[model samples]
Target: MQFFVWAAWLITIANYWFGTKQWDGADFGVIFSTMGISSLFMPTITGIIADKWINAEKLYAILHILYAATMFYLPQVDNPHTFFWVILVAMCFYMPTIALSNSISYTTLKNGNFDVVKNFPPIRVWGTVGFIAAMWITNLTGSKASANQFYIAGVSALFLGIYSFTLPACKPQNLISEKKTFAQKLGLESFKLFADYKMALFFIFSMFLGAALQLTNAYGDVFLDEFKLFPVFAESFVIKYSTIILSISQISETLFILAIPFFLKRFGIKWVIAIAMFAWVLRFGLFAFGDPSANLWMIITSCIVYGMAFDFFNISGSLFVETSTTPKIRSSAQGLFMMMTNGFGAVFGSLISGWMISKYFTTYYTNIGSLSKYVNSEADNAHLLNFLKNKGITVLQNGDLSRALDVKDWHNIWLAFTIYVLVIAIVFVVIFKHKHTRAEVEAINHL
Candidate 1:
């Protein structure tokens, strides 16, 4: 159930935004910003409901069903305006499922006598495997940019929603008896983590790093396909199989998630997270220099590095929260983590990157005013016509001769982002101070 839900969404949505909808950066920014706006409080609000009023599995299942319905209708959206609201509605129902899924999983695993930290990584790695599978399925079917990808996601969500009911029944705790304060009753007790210097710094860095995460997700596919601008590479395998190639990152994730339990034990959470931060530098730097033909290996290597860059922080950071917080406020702590990373970070990155791409990165090619602009020579008109034809664009008839293409300077764009992550890493290493003890991680597993 978890596998299918994640697999469907991450692999196709960006391509749908950049390729099919033909959204500009500003428009795309609005789409991602919705998560921040709604997700800011949705997870916590839902957590309170699930803990007090309803079953976790039931809440999760209903969210998936609503998510499926929203996605099913998403194809009918004709403009970014409709698309934005529809996606927001989907995200509102979808984001809390992340926390709720974890809640259900922990409850199920404990009931089954499986140690969470020791056993959960291996289980969660399958979600990455599922993600890789969906990417390949979409790319092989040539549906990454098609409405069919959303259909695929919707059908999967519908199935997951139904399948969830068969899983363990995670009934409400009705913990209202033990709670004392108004804020704690509302699951806001976890906000006290912000008052601590170390945690405050960690979350602040998480938001910054989350922005870098968003940048890569937002542009990786679009930038790879932008290689089509070069005639020699237009029909090359990279452009043809970009999403498949990008799936290497998710494939690498399965391997890395298995390594996290060891990494947290050996390096402790501090250095393990720092390794991820530096890996982001390599991820973006390699992409800046990579191309389809001679430098394809660079692109592949960048994808491989993405596993470490993404899973390291996400999995390891979650473990950090798991070990640090009491069970009473665990859901709230996790929700806060998601809010910082997915909500604030996503919004900040999307809105800012959209503006950056529109202002500095987007290129407007010379618009041909009249067919006669190239009439001086048959060779020139043939060249222009052939190029547009290759792009599958039609030549305007008669006086409607103006045509232009917008290309992005992907090289500079990625390099600037590489520098951005590199600086965040340096600042993280310098400013955030936490001394690790094995007891911190070991104590919880033994309990």
Candidate 2:
């Protein structure tokens, strides 16, 4: 339900903002930071509240209900600024539920006397399935670039929240009762790990790669959809089925996750992570050159590579943390990794990339008059007109353009991402060092 609710709007919303509402690219970029900002504190705060004062299941249900309500209100927002705040409120209610869901699962599983390590992963796999299903439904139903995506998600969230009541209760406990101080409750002691050179460096790179993660999610769907601007590709299957094509990444993610145990054992965590970084290099590089026509294979290959690009870094990095950190600070260390990657890293990626893309990659056409004046010859003008057509631009009855048409240079935007991840991969290979034993690899399974 969680995955379905998010997947319904997350990928395709780019098209809604850019294609439907005609909002600025920089503004669209800021919307993603809402997740990062909420990720920074809401999970911890909600975790504390759930641990000390409330039943985890009930809290999870209530948050989803609130998320659903907020999502329902989102389609009424006519402007990007108001849309940002409304989505921010939705994110605040939604982000923490990810952690809360896990907590509830573990508690329910334990109460059922099931082995969490053995059972939890299979259950989690269904979340990806849910995500893929939502994407397919959104695209097939013609809701990808419309407010109907939000309605689909809102309905799912509402159903999930109501259904959660039927699940086994996971009551609050005395788990953190001994940790009296607010700092202790929040696990601020994990901040001391930043003093260690290796741990600190690992986190710094995590943030860098985290930025890379957001780039694809933010732009990928819209990139394919933007091909519609070119008349040659406007009716192409790639534009029509872009979300389903993107869903291949999630499908690949599940399959690649199964291969991680082998990769970790064979290559060690550091090299596995390095491979993931390089995989990202390939992912972006392929996208940089891919098109909806003959270059379509590049797009498909890139989707396949995303599994290794994402799972190898995220899952392997978690194992590395589990092995390296002392048990006392281990849980907090995991939180710190997530914070650096999904929190600070997300904010860094979203805001900076937004500004950068708006400044460099996006082209604005004020009107037909400006377009003609900017072109060097009739031939070039004809070519530009053939490319842009009459899809997104607006004309005024007074003979002035009502809105500026913004077209993004997708090739260079992807090439820039490729270069960024490639540089990080090279720096990581040179600077970070770790030796893994067979026991260390095996220990991950036991944990």
Candidate 3:
């Protein structure tokens, strides 16, 4: 859990708007979207190798080692093109470990005579704790604005890589004697889920929601850091501690996870998910208007509500898939769920959002000394100015025209995303029909 958080916690801040290291949001989008692209096949492909050839633990260890290699080199990546490819290599190895970790946990627990369903949620909560710890570490160590967060993760991955060899072996289920079809041997049978009407709809919507998930991840810290452009809010705690502040959302997300069972019991999947859609509305809306200054509480509240917005749809959606699928396809269905959310959804969201941000919201600037109201972050000033220059924006110095300080139009950008999620909620309510009852809620226990 610590390693996972170390790997992810400060990515947006470290990659997006950090002083000298800042990359274009679109470039960051390309970097981040690689996880989705890799997810298209890596997990399934790796699963095949692990199931038929290598031990799962060994495969996981090697991936982490490779991932660490890429991460350690990230600080030296000065250009967006190189940044794109470097993180792509890292994500390819890192993304598969998500599924592998769950597999390891389940197999290890079961081997010890423990019930996975009952024990896993508690164990999973540690990931959230680790996320918060990582955020705190990044901020406290001043790595939130540096590339050291990647170093932290790289070192952790190295440690984890070596330690993984010590875990119980997870041998392949598809041995030579097992007469499996070529598709089954490749774990491609799950692709058949696309043929089912309900499942097809579910996965489609999962992709849409998955896009929403990437929005906050891509820009939440950038949003907070942007306040440094202003006077009063520049020294504000929220700006100074943007990464830590964003960690509130993850902390809140953890707490909301605990409420899933009760909400599932009472409201069932449909309402729980509807509530989640509504929460996304609130989440982005709050961020749209809230600032690091007076409306800071609204931003904090938005982070708090993120728990409901994220967990209800994602966690509950997993349960929906679980109860809906047969045991044979259950694992694959979950993978499909992840692919829709984290893969296709992430790719779609990142690319579109990145492009949109670059096209419409790219901050234009005049002289560096002009709109830089408070602190003198010349590198950030120069970066944004250079970014606008590349966009062919007309930025001059000293006049009515000189005051052309058109920074990121975050309001419209977020409003667009808010409308996107709102439309998704409305369409979902009308088309996706499920009659939820108390009996349906019983499936949570089986998980």
The top-ranked prediction according to lDDT is: 2
lDDT sort, best first: 2, 1, 3
Top candidate on TM-score is: 2
Candidate 3's clash total is 1
In candidate 1, which residue ranges exceed 4 Å CA deviation? 180-182, 322-331, 366-393, 397-404, 441-447
TM-score quality measure for candidate 1: 0.89
lDDT of predicted model 3: 0.78
Give the runs in model 2 whose Cα sits over 4 Å from its true position. 369-392, 395-400, 437-439, 445-447
lDDT over C-alpha atoms for residue 354 of model 3? 85
Error in Å for residue 358 of model 1:
1.3
Q: Ten consecutive residues with minimal summed lDDT in candidate 3?
A: 397-406
Displacement of residue 348 (Cα, Å) in model 3 is 0.3
What local lDDT does model 2 show for residue 313?
96
CA-lDDT, candidates in order: 0.79, 0.89, 0.78
Candidate 3, TM-score vs. the true structure?
0.88
In order, what is each prediction's RMSD in angstroms? 3.5, 2.7, 4.4
lDDT of 2 by residue, 235-298 (tens): 7999999999999999999999999888877778899999999999999999999999999999
Q: Whose TM-score is higher: candidate 2's or candidate 3's?
A: 2
lDDT of 3 by residue, 314-414 (tens): 98898888878788878778888898899999999989988898888777555645555433576666655654443344455542233344467878888
